[model samples]
Target: MAFADACNWINGNVNSNLTNRNSIQAICYSDVKSQFGLTANHVVRACARVAANRLTAKRKRRKVREFKPTSFDCDARTFRIIEEGYLVSLSTTEKRIKVPMRVSNYHIGKLQGRPSTSAQVCKHRDGNFYIHIQLKSDAPKLKKSKNVIGVDFGRRDIAVTSTGNSWSGKDISSIRDKYFRTRTSLQKKASQGTRSTRRRAREILKRLSGGEKRYQSWLNHNISSSIIREAIATDSIVAVEDLTGIRERTNQKPRNKTERRRSNSWAFYQLRAFLEYKGIKEGVKVIAIPPSYTSQTCQKCLHIGTRNNKSFKCENCGNNCDADYNGAKMIELWGCSVNQPRGSELLSCDINSRATESLHLPYRKCR
Candidate 1:
């Protein structure tokens, strides 16, 4: 009830520019504590957290109506490890509760003999209670790389690199197709069968819903790790296309049912996210450039080409290359252009210009 009250207060005070913690505390801290019977520390922490959240939402251009109530936010002062590692003493509005916790060895390793800074206690959809503890640690120094590698993400290829390496989506595609068939069969069973059969189909559908996401997450981890390792080997930065709003664009296009489903299901953003955090850890710079005309622009000549399926052919320069490869090259060139010294002449190159003309590689026909 105190949590909900704090959220409501935050919503009411959101438009008044109550962004600072001290400012919000001055306005509502005493009232919240007295009305909700919350402790002084709890009121302070709650007000600070709520104010921070509102400030973040405003910065993101989100309206006050979009703010949802947070479950609970507890600081280190409000919780303590009571029994070495298996029990937590948590403070609540009513009383302090000693909650038994089950933690893995990996979690223990992360603690590394350091104290946790804060924890958020929440209940999941599965009715399991969980606590997320935040720990502070010094980041490892990363080695800087010299070269740059571009990655082009697609449904068929998954990832194609500027270094001519590719991660195929054949296995993932097969897994998706299997799940797709299972879902289709389940839908038919649900629609045409009796009540019991429909219930069984629903159960099966719920069970299978998370499988594809887990499989894709696993694949993305593998792909991102490999890309990072490759970049580290070549001392290279990783360049990638900015695929924001890709789903909306895909939905707006004229696609068949299967194609639309596949496009929507493709985890382009997930792959990019994996690349970014892993790159930071490995000291590889991952840059995202606008993907405009990446596949259509010829890398060899300053000409816009026609892309048919996997092939891209340039009529003006007679340069033909794999479409994804060309896109990767374009991304790499864009990264290079952006990384150059400010006010450099290279920054003025057209999107279709031969940014790699200085490299002087022999043009090869598309296979």
Candidate 2:
């Protein structure tokens, strides 16, 4: 349609009383051009407008705020085939999107603004292109209703089994010490001047991301395997205390800038994320229970009271257990509550437990 006519129609019909895109699309292209003189260029821009408006409406429906128009950088970075037809700017890639195209070659997702990074594809009715990436490496399934486990993890250890076996922290302590040294050196260097400090900080951040990726990869792979193996061996649910709020409460101070940077490398979420997918893939149930009173309440008698930072004696059962163990025990209890049926039963099970479960996820806790 002519730009003027198109604009006039759009403005007048923008309301509920006006014709929708479907109605507009129903009109013959020839008639639209003849009546409105809309050029091919106008159609191209209109296509973009349609896509953008659809995305905006969808996001709003999903309660997503802060929507914005797609930027050139966003398009180039994510979409490999944006056929804006020969562009005049350095911003556009030389690659052309034309016919005989293998749909698999299109490697872009609708969301996240990142490449799909694969060569297989699924096309939706609305022309949403999905790349076929192997999102999961399947693990052997396990029988449900097997022996379950209760675990405790803390500053000194990562996992403690109900069988009294424990996996303590040679790795965690060593990493922390390494962080301390790096942090101290960075602090000493950064204290010199602003420009140098900024430069050093950037370099430190780079190193930290690399180190964190490595550390997380190792920890996630090893720990998830060990936990899953243990669960499989016993045919039991792996019960963990929900530590979701731990990050919000931590107030630890690093000795130096290097330590601070290294601390950032610690993918705290990786451990849980791995456990989640590992459980799903293995067909084992993993549960995270309420954290409160896990440490202070006695395991034997359900006692609740604060003691030393490391140890706590339950007031009810007089159970002498590590605070971390208490936390794990509480998690186990909460897990039990979750599996039960009925809203009343779920609530009746306990107030301290709030757990979220996932299905068939591959552990991506990058070491």
Q: How would you encode candidate 1's per-residue C-alpha lDDT over 1-367 as one tens digit per residue?
A: 5776776775575445767888888878777888878777788877877777777878998854533444677888888875475788888888899988887888667765678888888778687878888987665565554467889999889999989999898888888989999999999999999999999999999888899999999999999999999988888888899999999987998879988888889999999999999988777888898988888887766466569999888876678889999889877777777665552443344443443453446788998
TM-score of 2: 0.49
| Model 2 per-residue lDDT at 207 | 64
Indicate which candidate wins on lDDT: 1
Please list the C-alpha lDDT of all candidates, in the order they appear. 0.81, 0.54
Kindly report which residue stretches of model 2 are placed more than 4 angstroms away from their true locations once superposed: 1-143, 183-208, 251-266, 340-367
How much is the lDDT of residue 64 in candidate 1?
49
Q: Each model's RMSD to truth, in Å?
A: 7.9, 14.9
Candidate 1: stretches off by over 4 Å:
1-73, 81-87, 92-105, 113-115, 122-129, 136-146, 188-192, 248-253, 280-283, 300-303, 312-321, 342-367
Q: How well is each residue in 1-367 modelled by candidate 2, as lDDT tens digits?
A: 1343444444334342222455444443355445555454343333344445555656577421322222211122222433333111111122433322333233323322333332223454366544333322446664555355777766566666565666666676687677667766776666665896868776785566556357657866787788778888777778776677564455264357644544444554667778878888878877776666666655554434676887777544456767666666655555556654442342232223221131235777787
Winner by TM-score: 1
